[model samples]
Target: MGADGGTASALEQALSTYLAHLRVERGLSANTLAAYRRDLERYLAHLVASGRRRAEDVTAEDLSAFVTNLRTGDDGGRPLSPASTARSVAAVRGFHRFCSAEDGTPDPAVDLRGPSQARRLPKAISTSEVERLLDASSIGDGAVPLRDRALLELLYSTGARISEAVNLSVDDVDLEVGAVRLLGKGSKERVVPVGSFARRAVDAYLVRARPELAARGRGTPRIFLNTRGAPLSRQSAWAVLRVAAERAGLPHEISPHTLRHSFATHLLAGGADVRVVQELLGHASVTTTQIYTLVTPDTLREVYASAHPRAHD
Candidate 1:
């Protein structure tokens, strides 16, 4: 017999080992592990309630059925979206893969196909809208005006995520070189070049607004501060964008992410390669960055429909 004895016994042992691996070796966050645990628990409960006791007894059809049930099951008879169903399917698949590899059983979940989810395109604002938003930041005079201008300019210039921008420190920005070092998802760092407009706005903020704000907290290294000298929070950054959008006569719902989308779309329109934008955006996969290409194609269609003779019916 192996370390855990029979195949059934080994299945339980393997699950424990896998969970430990996720916690220790992978260093998955508590919330993530909790989510995994919840997903697996629901899946196993479904399997048990359906009279499937052994992990080895699960077939691809059974797994697929579970996904289907998840999609259609509801307390009040409401159906789940393809996206929500996919996440549940992913969780079950992961559990079965662990079972198969560590317990020497076939991975039935591998053959079970997930639900097809419609690809939701990223919403990118037009360049004219972006220009209007930036212009709105400059309407107010004095320190807050400089701060708002710098905040909006930097956001569009770097295409940094809202979190990355607000979390920045003074040391992360080099105005002379027009580069800001961003700490992206998974704590990975990359340096992105800023535009002249952003650089000038930042310089003004540092020389004027920052000093005033920093006085409230002795001295903080954060690039952006509120009335207090402490660094700006993500919530505050979002508010700044919303206020600026309102002032610009744009929709009140415009967010910091809208500026990011605009930045990517505009860059692609100006002939920058998608791969380059992927690196600048700190996306791990080029596929994630390819969504911006859709924006370009859409713009081309609009241009063709509008400008070409005989294009419109």
Candidate 2:
């Protein structure tokens, strides 16, 4: 071990054990666990660089400085986004809590509120742009054009995470009632209403395209299947969105989540209640869903500047 290895390994060993606890004990998803790993790697590196070595040595000032460092710059002196810094703080807090619980050390990060990150508004396409993207999905010449169209339509209609949508089984959909069941975070299930347009698109895909894909897998039950007849993965689903967006002449940032964001924002813009949006998005906390409520400041300012009676004569 090198001079810094002892301190570094102390943090590393704790991080690994905590991650294992999250994975096995808490049943955290693989994606979340991977994020925890990356965040903690940076955190542990910070501790080592600061010469912090012992499990019980982390002080509140040290924790505060760590977050400050994250905000100002990363180890390579590159600025991190507010969201990234916030996530790193969250990871550090979680690690300290684990250490306190297991080793009976004082947890400095326990009371630290972490950095307050401004809620970055989700990017949503206009209704017309969404229409174009959906239409573009059907333009491909493959046997799976219907499938591609259905996938995009379902994403917008259900406000589902791509992982939730791709993990769906045929049984998760109720065509007669026009709803799809999503297993969201923590395996919480919610049935979201599929609109008439989406229902029609999905029905056509099931009838025309799915059968051929299913033939290759010999009765696989996944709703969306790849060319190889395997269940559609998150990466492939994202690629599908990108391709459709490009074909429709949309911006490069039109991700699968953009459809979900559009679904939430459009619903709210049309006066759908925030609580209803919460339920539809399957958010565990309405607070998590409330970012959609933030209005565009530029739009609000423009309206106020134009409509006020005190405007320039």
User: For every model shown, what is its TM-score relative to the native structure?
Assistant: 0.77, 0.85
| Per-residue alpha-carbon lDDT of candidate 2 for residues 1-313, written as tens digits (9 for 90 to 100) | 1357677777778888999999888778888999999888877777777778865787777777777777787566566777888787888888888899998878878787755666678888889999999999899665588999999999999999999999999999998999899998767789999999999999999988898888888567899999888888899999988988889998648766899899988887776778999999999899977888674445446655788998657
What would the per-residue lDDT of candidate 1 be over residues 1-313, giving only the tens digit for each residue?
1232354344455456767777787676565678777666566656555556568788777786677777877322246688877777887777888777767989888877678877776777778888899888878666778888899899999999988898899999999989999988656789999999999999999998888888887677788998867888889888888888888888546866888888998998777888999999999999999988887886667767887999977
lDDT, each prediction: 0.80, 0.84
Off by over 4 Å in 2: 1-10, 72-79, 111-116, 296-313
Kindly report which residue stretches of model 1 are placed more than 4 angstroms away from their true locations once superposed. 1-62, 75-79, 102-104, 218-220, 251-253, 298-313
The residue-level lDDT of candidate 2 at 289 comes to 78
Backbone atom clashes (below 3 Å) for every candidate: 0, 0
